[model samples]
Target: MSWQLYEKARGLLSEEFGGIKKSFGGKITIALCYPNTYQIGMSNLGFQKIYYLLNQHDDVLCERVFLPFPKDEFSFKKKNIPLFSLESQTPVHNFDILCLSVTFEADYINILKILNLSHIPLKCKDRSEKHPFVLMGGICATFNPEPLSDFIDIFFIGEGDEAIDEFVDAVRCFSLAINKGKDGFYKRLSTIDGIYIPSAYDVTYKDSGAIEMVLPKNGFPQKIKRRWVKDLNKTPTSSKIITSNTVFGDMFLIEVERGCGKHCRFCLAGYSYRPVRNYSAEVILKEVSEGLRHRKKIGLIGSAICDSPYIDEICDGIAKMGGTISVSSLRLDRLSKKLVDLLSVSGHRTATIAPEAGSERLRRVINKETSDDEILDAVQFMTSAGLTDFKLYFLIGLPTETDDDIDAIINLTKRIKHSILKIAKSKGHLGNITLSVNPFIPKPFTPYQWERMEDTKSLNSKIKMIKSGLKGVSNINIIHELPKWSFVQALLSRGDRRVGELLYKCCELNGDWFKTFRETNINPDFYIYRERDFNEVLPWDHIDSGIRKNYLIKEARKSKEEKTTLPCPEVGECRRCGDLGCVMNI
Candidate 1:
């Protein structure tokens, strides 16, 4: 091991507040890895919560491993240093299990990089009894595990809060069996509620390269059901470790809720994370009180935080404790005067809102219910509360997008700029409005899953149109993601196990995806550019997200007709999506 690398880890550990270090004797060793840099991984609350939960087991000693920075990665490659955990500096391959928390498709390549650095076999078929079992979880894996199926031994389907404990128990029960071989242990884990053993299933494809069927082994279930925590109150997710080296370093993070009730047709989180659940104000305030003891700022985490019924009460309670607050983004339709005032008082100069589409017609197509008037009113409210700068998010190249829709975006942004300047001029101060534009990538399990992503050339042209239309406008700045990268994301998001082969080849070429495509027989465009028929089987058909496929089809039809589905009722027995009353119970 390199002394420089060991000392670097020790320095990071020294600065952290609540990291756990325990004896490895008689414990199940897990190297919880995040396939990114330390700065990015440490900022993720989900990764931290999993670390906290795994170590909560008296028999499980969990440590963190992250993708090394460029210079450190070079040191590992040149000096042949094995990847080690942050807490103990032990080689990751020495652990019994390597649990990867993957959140984005772009990080798929980084997973291979981490595995390579750790000296672990990149493919599950290549490993033996001596190799650590590879497990993956988080939103990306939960939605579609096929692309990584060849590399990962097991995939945990849903929220890790309760399911992880069950997984650990299974591991402990099958400890002796694991020494024999992974086959029997894999079969045993296949019986768990949320566990999916990829090797235990066989995927067949048609001549046209579409999935014919996904069949499980005789003992395994035909479909793997996603497990979720029934009660957010019981499982209070908060920052277990505090460090000064993260993005939200100055704040204590807490999860106030999970899942979104608004069924935006294009959103993966909305479809996959069904049945919205919120922590009661009492629970949030108690967590806040504890958080205030450590940091003056509290970061509230959730998909629909402002939609919580007790949002006002929670904000007021935090303010009463002399703690400031921050959130990822705000819901335009749900903004309130009290919330805006609290944010302004907390010294928030910038706020973000996602209008998604510019035209009201396109908004209906995506089921983003906020109208143009509501968007302007939200801007007015925030500016009146003393928040100076604003970030507006929009998507280009959506399904059925037209030139008029692109023009609408430019026109809408101009109106927002006008509104901001009207407020700033009177206050004798100027504020900027930034447009964060991105290409629309089709994701699995959503209504748009079967739709084709617009070509990169077309997407880039639309982006240019927006930039050109708003050229020379004062105090208005624009930024966008490269359409080419979004195309790659679309390919990975909707790809099958065959895509795994392409991924391996890409890694061998040092992430030259273009060269990987040119050298391989697999066609990347087939995955992203072709629209699928409703009768065809999808890559993720075997993974049951509880919302029926038929329900998704129905929603797709509604989108075609420019119709909007109502939000899931807070108190009702409606089973529109066939979730079996998960909404009412929550």
Candidate 2:
């Protein structure tokens, strides 16, 4: 059984391209561990990007390891087998460094599972010098590393492309330095920019369980500035591996842009990844041409790929090459006819737009900066351009949302569907609309970061209200994310290290978050249902994600007043956010 499991892993890796095949002798053996299944982890471009970057180094040998399949975990534990990597089939614990790519907060428990299966200590302090040093990176780690800080030795607080070289160089330097111990290496690692050694910091809490302060010691910087590649054109991001076993399978993915210029107050990615960046048209087309050789489908991914200045050219180039182009959601206001026409020619049937809120007032509150007319116009253009399927995205439980706003969603969708049907009738076809609604979870570093997530009872009430309001609407499908699950997301998103225990309990209960909460004596309300004061220290306050707290505070105040911030300053000076020393030229 154990041999079968190991072979299964080997078989999966054998299907990939651009994976590292290196000799581990006299090299920094690093296990690039993802706390998830192989199929899911392999699908992530960021994970693939890190693997590509780490393996480019001659002194480092990075191998892939993931949380075992449930059945395989049982088989391994029964056989007393240690978790091993796909490349060398070496035990994960035998590596010098364990670099974890954690994008989602829910995967926190899975990290623990991976540790236990590998026979490594779960807590950072529990591990001796003999054990592999664990470092974490990804979107989740940059903004809020505190939740999993206890278990992780180091957190890379920036883009992997920018931090990987610095990180590996630090590791190389530390290995050769005098006093090759944990403490010495940690201090050395801290000196490198964007590396946060959690143990070097002390977090104090107030009597009300709110953060009092987070103080850094041992010469660690109190604030770690997020790093970015100065010129995005220099480091173009694209898929390195191609497999048919995952989402976007067999589709070559390229990141056209990074960081959103739209300062949507409810979005964490918008603020956490500051100062928009995009690859030039030449670079994008070059990558797309290379991708066409391997796969005919191209997926343009980024927070704001539509905002790429050369988006029309990129789309047209792909269309001319006879390659199908897929994209992330389009910005309604920024939606273009040429792009939509190219997408239609590429065989895309559905177009997605996130209005975020149904009501204009609520849109203003969230700084969505999109109007109803703008959304309808975009939809009309897409529907007329041969796109029949329409997907509208929205968020419930917004800061100032009401029942009227919920009803507006139904009315708005009806208008969009009416437009779609008219366009489709002329083409002798019908249309379908899918509404993907989610409950808003105020995230760290956003203007709404200090706001409370609506209670599950209130969230459920709103969901039902929307459902009833949309009842009997033909050709329209409503899919809402479970609010109860979002409560767990909010808890983990803004939680401290103490929440790690709750995560462990949940794993023990077989992923039962409710029972875990009850058994751990944790009140989900404390994290989700209470509004925070401006004076209170947030869990992620120590991490400088290129945004100022005062700016966020002012933005929060503006949200209450239904005011909006301008789009990101891509051309001129916008001193509205970030610290004084930000690298953004604008």
Candidate 3:
């Protein structure tokens, strides 16, 4: 409640963040935080969106904060200076709430660092009414919040547009009633939409290694429907876009659609965000008009931008307005001429295609039914439409992946390059193609959860062999992720509540992963590299996200048996996914 930190954070805002100072209006201090370093956090569109959203609230002023970089962390520790918000150089503790936007499993530890910097306790039980209430949102919260539940005060599930608005309203009301309000705000806040107070529930694990029951102990609803905007077109993306310091700097971001119907077996987004939705053509044009004022380039954001019925119209509108556009990779099976022509005319030279796998056989395992011929056809379209450069994305080490199946990577890329070359010779155009090889990490609730990740050595060898085979394909190039990051991601994604210790240790050691491992008593490999039994109880069993465990088990069984499952049509009740209790419900 002290203004000391707020003054420091406000100083930072005035000195470094020009846009933030302009939006501050000399009152109402709030810190919109991305729980990672400036370099990495600034890259996320969600983080930027929240920064833009909060600042636009007239009565409320928004500032910025990110996880301190390693060097900055050392400097702060040496000087004993607390972490401050970007806008006012105000201390993180001074804000009414320290709102964190967490997008990935790995960033869980970073929240601990930000909290420690704010002089707040790492664990929730260690804090009191004197501290800033910590609230978190984003994809991980939507899927699973139990592992980190003991620390965060509030977990927001699903889309934040509607959920956060409700949260802000509740906070404002609480601010007005603080002097005479009843006790246990956590219990009261849990009653709000999309809000799950982790402290209000009780869980009983059965002896059979399953969650026996999750009873709502307080006055909170048992089920929290995910907040979704009925009319996404009017939901922001306005002129005051925050692009100056972000990864996609000076680029306008426009949403073409939200949700998807592809319903891939191993994809959580395919299941969790049910019933596809999109912006109308008119709304899209309006968004773009506002976006282009800040930047000349547009990055269309969505699960399947191509699937938006009005994608062509939107792309054309941007082009006609003298803006360039970058698109998400497509199914290739659905790449259309109007889309290609619109992009080509805008001087867009590179197009991306996500085949997911080299062979159609592996594609079927993931429910990506696009054929090799279809992919080749898309390459031909890109080439013929005067867009020569292309990037191909593929996954390796999926369940049922064999050496023969992997050869398709080389085969497909070379064949694609040959087609592009043949067309280029006739059409007098030259082009280069790139193939980004990524390893497939099986995730929980996905059909492949039952499958084991391919041994790291084997996957790397396969990558090397594939690259070796491309000796003569000059037009083709290859790039891939370091295997270690994937290994860490696997370790974190499925880890139990026990991992909180490791994450806290990680941030405490200045983001040193190795030292964090040494300090922890638990073996991370046990949760990461080890396989789980079908009857084992997971750490995230307490939160209810609306999906069912039975369905996930069935899907896992189907994947194990090499059988394909069809997506339920968007007709009636959306069947629950196997993981029942999740913050997605929260």
TM-score of each: 0.98, 0.97, 0.87
Question: If both were scored by lDDT, which would come out higher, candidate 2 or candidate 3?
Answer: 2
Between candidates 2 and 3, the TM-score winner: 2
Per-candidate local distance difference test: 0.89, 0.85, 0.71
Best by lDDT: 1
Question: Which digits, one per residue and each the tens of the lDDT, describe model 1 over residues 145-188?
Answer: 99999999999998877587678878998785536567778887
Cα lDDT, model 1, residue 317? 95
- Give the Cα-based TM-score of candidate 2 against the true structure: 0.97
Residue pairs that clash (backbone atoms under 3 angstroms), model 2: none
* Candidate 1 residue 444 C-alpha distance from true site, Å: 0.8
Candidate 1 colliding pairs, count: 0
Worst 10 residues of 2 by lDDT: 577-586
Per-residue lDDT of candidate 2, residues 293-385 (tens digit): 989989998898778878888888888888888887888887767788878987889988889899889999999877788888888788889
